[model samples]
Target: MAYVGAATALGLFAPRAWAQEGAPAAAGAVDGDPKAFGPERHGLSAFGELQYPADFPHFDYVNPAAPKGGTFSQVPPNRSLNQSFTTFNTLNAYILKGDGAQGMDLVFDTLMARADDEPDALYGLIAKSVAVSGDGLAYRFRLRPEARFHDGSRLTADDVKWSLETLKARGHPLIAQSIHDLERVDIESEDVVTLRLSPKRTRDLPLTLAALPIFSKAYYSAKPFDASTLEPPLGSGPYKVGRFEQGRFIEFERVADYWAKDLAVNVGRSNFDRQRFEFFRDRDVGFEAFKARAYLFREEFTSRTWATGYDFPGVRENKVVRETLPDLTPSGGQGWFFNLRRKKFQDPKIREALNLAFDFEWMNRNLMFGAYKRTVSVFQGAPEMMAMGAAQGPELALLEPFRDKLPDSVFGEPPVPPVSDGSGQDRNLLRQAQRLLREAGYAPKDGRAVNAAGEPLTIEFLEFDPGLDPHVSKFIAGLKIIGVEASIRMVDAAQYQQRMNAFDYDVVSQRMSMSSTPGEGLRQVYSSESAAVQGSQNLSGIAYPAVDAMVEAILSAKSREELNVACRALDRVLRSLNFWVPAWYKDSHTLAYWDAFSHPAQKPRYTRGAPEFWWWDAEKADKAGVKA
Candidate 1:
C-alpha cells in the first residue's frame, strides 16, 4: 500500500548508485530540466523507496554468516525465456531458436539483481550504482571496479551496450518485443553506461534493462549470437557452466574467485559449490527419480502425486522431508488459454460456454483430493489487482472511457465462473452452455454441434504430457455431453513449444507468474503487439484496443494505489473477455526434498530460495543415510 511521493512520481525507477554517497554540486537545475541528475542510489524499485538502504550488510532474508559448500540438485520448477522443464538442446538460453537449458542465467550477471525479499526492488550486482535523468528517459550505471568474467577479464560498460542492442534485435520474440522501446545504449566509458529509452517506453523499462544478462562482447564476437550452440558463453556471475549431458543434466560450478561474491547483494546466497538440474519428460518418472535420490529436491505441481505418492519408504523413515511454504508471489493467469487467432475461438460467447463447462468443484474433490481452490481472475493471487464484487471509484473511472468497447460486465459485478453442482456432469451448467452455444449459432446436428455454415464445432486440447490426459478427458467428456466435439492431442515437449510459438494449437494449458509489482510484463502477455509476435507469451492472442489501453494505464500509474486500480480494471476487462477457461492455483509451494539440506531462518518473500540459499546439512545427511 506504499505510494511514491509527488517529488519521485515520475514513473521512473528510483535512483541508486552502489558505494557512492553524495551528489556533485548542482547549478540549480530544476526538477524537469533534462540536464538535472539524481543522487547516487544503491538500488531501484517499481514505486516508492527501496527496502534496503545503501549501507546494509546483506539482505535480511539471507543468513550472511552461513557457510558455503554443498551440492544441490533438482528438476527445474520454473523456466524463463527459452528454457524447457523437460530437456535442453542448446546452451544459448536467451534466444528463440532452441530448447534452452535452465540455470544458464546462473552463469550470467545482470547490471542489477533483484532482492527476492521485496516485490520489485533491485540492488547493484555488476554495476556498483545507478542514477536516473530528470526527464526519466535515461539511466546511468557505474560498473563495479572488481567486476570480472569467469576468465578474469574485466567486464565493461561497452559489453552492456552491446548486449542491449544485440538482444533487442536477435533475442527471443518475447524479449525483443519487451525491449523494443530501448532507443539506445550510450557507453560513457569502460565503467559507466547510459541507457536512453524511447518516449513511448513503459514505466518498468529501466528495471528490464538493468536486469538483462550481461554477455561477454569478446566471447560472442567470434561466435554467432543467433545460432543454437552447446558452447557455454563467457559470463561474470557467481557460477559458470561446469558439466553437462546435452539432454539429461547440466551443472554449474560455483566460481571460487567470483568478483561480486562478497557484495551485499550476493551474501549468503548461491551457497552450493555445485548446482544441477536433472531433466525428465514425465512427472511420474521425475517423481520416481526423486525417490531413487536422482535429484535432491522436488517442488511438486501435481495434486494427486502430493496426495498419494508421498507415502514412500523415504517419507516413512524420515529420510525425506516436505515443506508447505507459502508462495506470496502472484499466480497470474493459469488456465487453458484459447488461441484467439483461431477462427473458432474468436467468439466471446463460445469461450464463456467453455469456461462454464469446467467442473472445478467436482475435480478438486475427487481427483485432486481437495487440494486447490477454483481460480477466477487473471490476477488471481495478487489481491491488489483482483476484481471483486463490483467496480467503483478509480476502477470505474479508468474503465468508463472504454465502456462502449467493453462487455457490460465491466461496469457491473465481475462475472464469476459458474459454480458447478459437484456432480461431475452438471446438467444445469451444460444446459446453460448449450444455450450460449446456440445463441452463438452453434447447435446439435446429428448429435454433434455445428455452425450454420455446416462447420463442425470441434476443439483440440494440445498437451505435451500424458499425466494431464485424465484432466483433459473429463473436460472433453463434459463438452461431448453438451454436443461439442473435443479431444486431446499429445505431443513431445519440444514439439509442444514449437507449436505454441507458431500459435498452431487450438487451446493449451499454461500458468503465467506475475510480479506482485506488475508493470511492463503486461504488454508481453496481453498487448496487441505481442499477439502478433511468434514466440511472445500472448498465448491467447489477445489484441483488443481496450486491453492495450488498460495495459497502458497500468504502466502509467505513478503510485501503488494507482497501479492497483489500473490492475483491477484490467482484471475486470480480461475476465469479461473470457479468453481462458480459468484453472486453479495454490498459494503454497509443495516442496519435497531429501533431509540432507538446511536453509536460512526466513525464505525470500518473492522466491523459493531453496537449494540456492541452502547449505548441505552434513549431520542430517549422515543420520538419514541420504546422498548429498
Candidate 2:
C-alpha cells in the first residue's frame, strides 16, 4: 500500500523530443537552458552527464573503461542461445528484429527507448519526439536529420514506413495482430512520419511503436530480409557490432559519431567504452572465469558459494565486491505451471489441491537455507501488482466474468498455512482436501487417492536444469508426505524447451520476466490465444473466457484507474486457478563489480538488465582507473 511521492510522479514526465521540425535537441540536452554555458558559471560540465554502466536500470551494465578486447561471458543454464527460428510470436517489431536475447540491444534502436531503471518512461533514441492526435487515432514521429545508419546513409521517414510494414508483412500473426489497426503510414516530410490508426482506441500503440527497431531500408533492401543470415547487422544506436565469432563472443564498440550521444537520456549513460559478451554453455565455467577476473562482475548463487565461495584469494585482496539490490521488479513468475491442454488436469479442484500441498515455509528453511521466499504474486515488487494485498471493491468487479465457474474459496481468501512446521500436516486442510478429492470423483483406497478409473492421483514435475535438482527434490519429497505420487523429471535446456513448445508435460517448473506494464503482461500469461502459442508464452496452458475479456478491457483502458480495475480482475482469475505456485524473489538485484570504476552520483532509474548505459562515461573513465 505504499504510494509514490509527488517528486516521482513528475520524475518520468519527459516532453516528447520527436516530431520537432529542427535538428534533434543537440544529442542529449532535454532538461536544460540552451543558453546556459561557460567554465565561469558551471565549471565547464558538458550539457549532459556521462557515467559507467550499472548506472542505469533494466539494462545490461557495460564497464566504462573495460577494454574493447576481452570477452564477457554470461552463464544462463536455462535456455540455449542458438535458436534458428522462434516458435512464439510477439506484436513488438523489435522482438522480431534480432535473435531475442538480453544482448540484442547492441544492434538495434527503438523509436522511443526506456532507461534501464524506469521501464514506463519513454526516451527518444530513434525518433526525436512523437505526438499523438487528440482523438488518439494518429501518431507522428520526427526523425533526426543527423541520424544515419552504421553504413552512413541518412535515416528518413521511409525507414520508419518500412519498419512498420515489414513487421506486418513478416511478423507472426500474433505479433501483427497488435498493430492490425495501424491503417496507414504517411511520410509527412523528410523527417516527419505520421500513422493513422483504426478508430478503435489502441492503448498499446505507443508501446508497440516504441518497440519497433528501425532498420536501414537500404541494408535490408540490398538483400531480402532473412532470419537465417547473420550478415553483420547494421544499426543507428550508440553502439555498433564489432565482431561475431559464433558461440564465442559478440563485441560492440562505441559509435564515434553517434548522433543521439548528447541527448539527456543518453548522457552519463552507456559509459562503457567497449562492450563484449562471452557465451558459455556451462554456468560453472562462467563463474570460474568471473572469479579469475575474466569478467568484471558475476552474480553468484548457491549458498555454499555466497557464504564460502568468496573466501578465495581474490576476495581477500578485495578484487571484487558483491552487492544485493532487493527485487524491485518481479523476480519472474516462477512456479509449477499446469498444462490445461491435457484433459487429466482439467479439474479446478485438482489444481487447487496440488497448490495446497506445498509447504513453502519448510522448503524455504530446510532445502533452500533461507535463500528463497514464497512468491506473493506475479510482478512481486512492482507498483501495480494485482495481488491479494491490493484487491478491493473496484478490483473485485473485474473478476465477475468468471465468478460462476470459480470456487468462492479461490477468490474468498488466501489459503492458510498448515498447523505444524515440517513436523506434521494440518488435519483440517487435509480433511478439506479429501472432501474436494472425493467430490471430484476420487475414491480413497488403501490410503491413496484414486480416480474411478483406478488411476492414482499423481503429478509429474518437469524441470530443465541440473541446478534445480536440490529444490525440485525437496518439493517431490513434500508431495510424497502429502500422499500424492509426485515424480521429478530432468531434461537439458534444449530438450526442456522442445517439450514446453509442445505442451507435452503435466507440470513445469519455469520462470518469466514480468513487465512493469501490467495489462500487456497479464495477457501474455493468461490469455486464451497465449495458451495456444505452444511455446510463445502462457506456459501454464491457461485458456478462459473471463481472462480473454479482461485482457481486452485492460488494453482498452484509457486511464490508470480503469487499467487497475481490469488488471485486478485478471489477477483474481489467475490466483483462483493456482496455475503458478509462486516462488521467492531477491529484494534487489545482485551485482559484483571491480573497484576501479566510478559512475554518476545519481541512483539508476532503469533496469539492472545487462548492457546498461555505462558507456556514457567513456570520456572520463580512464581517470577512474578503468582500463580500455
Candidate 3:
C-alpha cells in the first residue's frame, strides 16, 4: 500500500527494493561534502550514496524480459487491519473517513520510486531528476516532459505543488502531520518544482516528499477531495481503474500507453495485465476459497493454519506450491501496547510486571505450532540498528546525558521480555512479577491486585481480529493468575481503528513496520509531542524526553555510522521503558499459490513483489487445472 509517512500505524509496506545494476557516479560528481548538493540525479539515498546511477537499465530483482498478459488475483497480506479490507467506500486512500480499497496505491504514481535492495534510496518516477540545495533546506525536482495523467493531460510542477498543498491541508491526520515541517512548495517553472523545508527537519525529508503520490489537481477541482466516494480519481500510474463491485472486488488494468512503462525503476514490474483483489470477511473462508481456486495466491499468517491446514488435495496433487521466502529487512515492532495516558499503567514497575507476566514460550509452542521467534527490540532482527549486549561505545556516549532520566538498565544489557518454561504457568516468573507489583504500591487484596485506593487492577485487551482471541485469551488467563482482572474485548476493524485513533482503550494490539533508515517517523511513535495528537502513531503514549532526544539524534545523523549509533541508542531506551509486551515474528514469508505463475529466479531481499513481478503461465494453469 502507499503509506502516508515513515511511521505507518497500520498498512505500511517495507522500503522499496534497491537497484543494484548500475555503478555509482564518478568521484567528482558528489562526495563526502554535506554542504555541497549534487547536480540533478536519478535517485537519492538517505545517508549514503545511491546504488544505481542515472543511466541504469533496470532493478536487479526484476526480469526485464518477463511476459505480462495474465490476470493475478489474491488476498492482501494479513499484517494489519488496513491491509485486510472487507469493503471499500472510497477510492481516496489518503482520507480517514472510510476504509479504502486495497491496492489503490497501484492507481497513482509517486514522484520517486523506492529501491527494495537498499536501506533508504529513491529513484525518480514522475520526476526525471531531483536536486537538493547545499544547505539541505531546498529541494528541486524536474518533472519528466513525457509524464501524463491517465486522462492524457500533461503533468507539470503545478500538479505537484497542488498535491503537496492539498494533502497537507485536507488529507488524513497522519498525512497532515507528516508534512507539517514542509514549509512550502514553490513552482519554479512549468516543469521544475522546489520544496522548502522547515529548519527543524531531517535529511530524509526530501526523500519522503519523493514518495508522495501525486494527484491531478483538475480532477479534485470539480470533485470533493475529502469525501469518501466510490468515484475513481484520475491517476498516471501504469494501472488504471478497471472494474469493481464496490467492496467485493476491484480490478486494475495495465495501461498500454503508460508514460513511464520503460523507466529503469519499472521495466520488469506491473507484469499482470489485469490485477484484482478479492475480499473475504473471514480468514478461514478466504483459505477455503484459495483451496477452490477462487484466488491465485495466498500468504499464510497463522502458524497453525500453515502447519496443519495445508494437507489438502491441491497440494497433494502437486497443483499448488508452498514456499518460504526469507525476509532480510528489520522485523518491526509488534506487541500489546499499553496506553501510558492511563494513570494505572504509568508506574514503571507495573509495566515491567505486565511484561514479565505474559508467557510467550507457552503461546508459541502450544498455539503457534512452534513457528515464531520472540521480538527483542524495536529494531528486532536488524543487526546494525538493534542494541545488543549492552549500551557501549557511541551508543553509550549518546545515552550518557540522559542517564539521570533513564533506568540503570539502559546502561547495562538491553532488557528483553521474560522467558518462561513451556508449561504455560511459570510460577517462578509469577512470583517475581508479584514482587514488582508490590513494590509499585499494588498489594494482593482478597487474591486480587489492588492499588493504594483499594481499587482492583483491571486490564482490557482490545483486539480487532477475531482470529486473535485464542492467542489473546491465553495472555489474559496468565494475567488472571497474577491477581489481575484482564479480559479480551473484540471489535470489528472499523471500531478498532476508531478506538485506537481516539486512544480509548487500555491496551491494544499494534504492529508498526520500521524502515531500514529510520527518520522523522520515529517521532510520531516515541516523541512527546505526538502523545496527545489523535490518530498519531504514539500507540504506547510514550512521552519520555530521553526517547525524544534519541529521535532527534537519529534525525540529525550525518553519516551512516552516526545513524546506526543513534538508532541503537533509541532502541535501547525504548526497550528499557518496557512500554510494550513484545510479540513474535517469522523471519520468512509463507506463501502458497497455484503453479501457474512464474517469477524471476531471484526475489528482492526486502519485498515480496507478488503480482507486480510474477507473470501468469497459461500452460501451467492448464496443466494444473486452475482457471485464471
Candidate 4:
C-alpha cells in the first residue's frame, strides 16, 4: 500500500511507480538532468526520453472519441493511506485516521499528469508548462488559467502552496516522509507556482512534487485537514465526490463541464459517468455480490476463486466476461513483513528461520492453484532492478562501501527463497529452521521455542479480515513444526489501521510495487527516518546505515541505469536480511466483470486501466440486464 501519493500515483496518496513505454530521447539527458527539464518542458521523464511532445494529441493508449456515460463499479483494486480492502469509515483518504474510502483520487487534480504509455513521463495536466533551474533543485509550474475547482473558484498557486504545507504538517506520516526534502513552495502568480527543493533532494523529488494532489485552501480552511470526516473535500479533477456513505460505498460523479476533460492529458480517460466502490468484509462475499450485479466489475485477487468459483448463472449465460490482462508494472514488494521494531525479530538469523518455515512450493500448488511464482525480489517483476546472481559493474561498485555492514552472501549471490520439496510440511526445511533458531540462541521443545530468558518467541500474524486465514493457518502450522509460536489475529479494518499506525503487530502483510522510475518514494518504505515515523510504510522498521546509504544512491542516481543499479544493490542487502517471507506473484491480472463495459483497444502499460478507460456498452448492458 503506497499512498506515499498513489491514488494511480498522486493526490492523497504518495508515489508508487512511474513507468511507461517510449523510445529514449535522442537529445540525451537534457541539461544532464534526469527528468529532461530543459527550457519550458511540457513533459518530464526519469531518463529524459519523452515520446509525447508538447503539441501531442491524446495519449496513444486512449480512445479520444470514446463516449462517456456509464456506471463502472467494483471493489478497490489496491489501497493506500487509510483505505481498506474490506471497509471504509471516512471520505478523507489522505490522513492517518479512520479507514479512508477508495476512489478519492478522482476528486482532485495534480499539477501534472502521467502519460501511462511512457514510463516515468508526466505531461501537464492542471499546469500549462514547467521550467526547472540549472541546479535541478527549483521548478516553476505555469498552471492553466482555466483550471477551477468544483465550486468554480480558480485553482491558484496559493492552493498548491497551502496543500503542500498542510500535507507535510498534518497528512499521513508516509506523505510527510516522502516530501521531507521539499524546501519551499513560492507562488509567483495566481497561475504560476515555483517549488524549491533542498540541494540534497532526490532526483525524482521534482516528479513526486508535480504528481502531488492539490487541495483547495478555502475548503480546508473551514475544516480540519488531519481528522477523518464524511464530508467530501473540494476537488478540481474530472470527477467530484457525489454521494457516499461512511463505510459501505462511495461514488464519484463525472464533472459534466470538467475543466480539463478536453485537455490532451485527459482526453478519452475518466470515461465512466459514475465510478463506484463497494465494500465487502470478505472476498467470498464480494464475489457473490459481483454475481448478483451488486457491483459491475471485479479484478479477481484470489486464485482459487478464479480457478473454480465462476460457474454461476451469469457466466453460464454469457452475461459476465472473464479475461486476463498483463500487469506490466514491477511486482514491487509483497509479503508478510516482520516488525523489526520488536526485539525478538531484530536478529537476522531468526528472521531467516521464520521465512524458511513457509512452504511456498506447496501453497502455490494447493492453495493458489499454481497461479503465482514465488516473489523473490522487492523489485519482483522489474528485470532492470531485480538483483540476480552476484552484483557487478556499477552495482557492485555501489555496494562496495557497505560491504562490511551487509552479509557476505550479498556479495556472492543474491538471496533466494528456499524451494520446498512440494510438501506442505517439509521436514527437511523444518529441521533447517530449527537449526537456525538454535544457532540464534533459542531452545526448541514441545512445538515452541524460547529465548535464553525463557520468553516464548511468539508472532501474531495481523490481518484485517479472514481473506488469508487458509494461507496463514497453514503457515502457522509450519512455524509450529520449527518451534515458532505463530498465531493469526483478525481485527476489524479500523483496528488494523490503528495497530499498523502504532506499530503494535509482530507481523503484518503488505504489498507495494515500484514505478519504472523509482526515487523518493523508496525512502518512505526503506529510509531510517521513515522507520521512526508512526504511520509510515516502513513496516519492517528498517533502520540501517547501509540501507540508508542504498536509498540515497537510488535518490541521487542521474540515469535510469544508475537507478537500476542502486535498486539491485539495495535488493541484495534486503534479501540477505530476510525482513519478509516473500510471497507469490503473477504478472497477469485476472478480471471478471459483467458484460456491461467496453474499453479502448490499447491499455496503459503501467496502470490497471480499467474504469478510467472503460466506456459503457449499451447493447452489452442490455444483454446483461444491468443499469449503465
lDDT of candidate 4 over 493-605, digit per residue (tens): 88988998899999988777677676766777887988878887888899988889898888667667777889899999888889999887888878899999888877899
Candidate 1, TM-score vs. the true structure? 0.95
Q: Give the least accurate 10-residue stretch of model 2, judged by summed lDDT.
A: 1-10
Q: For model 1, what is the error of residue 260's alpha carbon versus the real structure, in angstroms, after optimal superposition?
A: 0.7
Q: lDDT, candidate 2, residue 43? A: 7
**Candidates' lDDT values, in order?**
0.81, 0.55, 0.79, 0.81
- Please give the distance, in angstroms, between residue 63's alpha carbon in candidate 2 and its true position after superposition: 13
Clash totals, every prediction: 8, 58, 8, 17
Model 2 misplaced regions, further than 4 Å: 1-102, 116-119, 172-174, 222-226, 301-304, 330-332, 387-392, 414-420, 423-438, 442-449, 482-485, 609-611, 615-628
Worst 10 residues of 1 by lDDT: 1-10
> What's the TM-score of every candidate structure?
0.95, 0.79, 0.94, 0.94
- Flag regions of model 4 displaced more than 4 Å: 1-38
Q: The CA-based lDDT of model 2 is what? A: 0.55
- How accurate locally is residue 604 in candidate 2, as Cα lDDT from 0 to 100? 53
TM value for model 4 = 0.94
Q: What lDDT tens digits, residue by residue, belong to model 3 across residues 1-628?
A: 0110122732142242211112133111246764444577788776547778779899998999988788899876632323334556567778766777777788889999987777778898999987766556677889999999999999889999999888888877666766687899999898999888887765556666778789998988888888878887899999988898876888989998999999999999998888988877676888899999888898887787898899899999999999888878777887888999999899989998888789989988888888888888888767898887878888999999989988898989888888899788899999998899999988998889998889988999887556677878888887888889998887776776678778999998766777777776777678998898777788888998889989888877777688789989998899988899988877787889999999888888767778778888888988898766
- Report the C-alpha displacement of residue 134, candidate 3, in angstroms: 1.4
Give the range of the ten consecutive residues with the poorest summed lDDT in model 3: 18-27
Candidate 1: where is the Cα deviation over 4 Å?
1-32
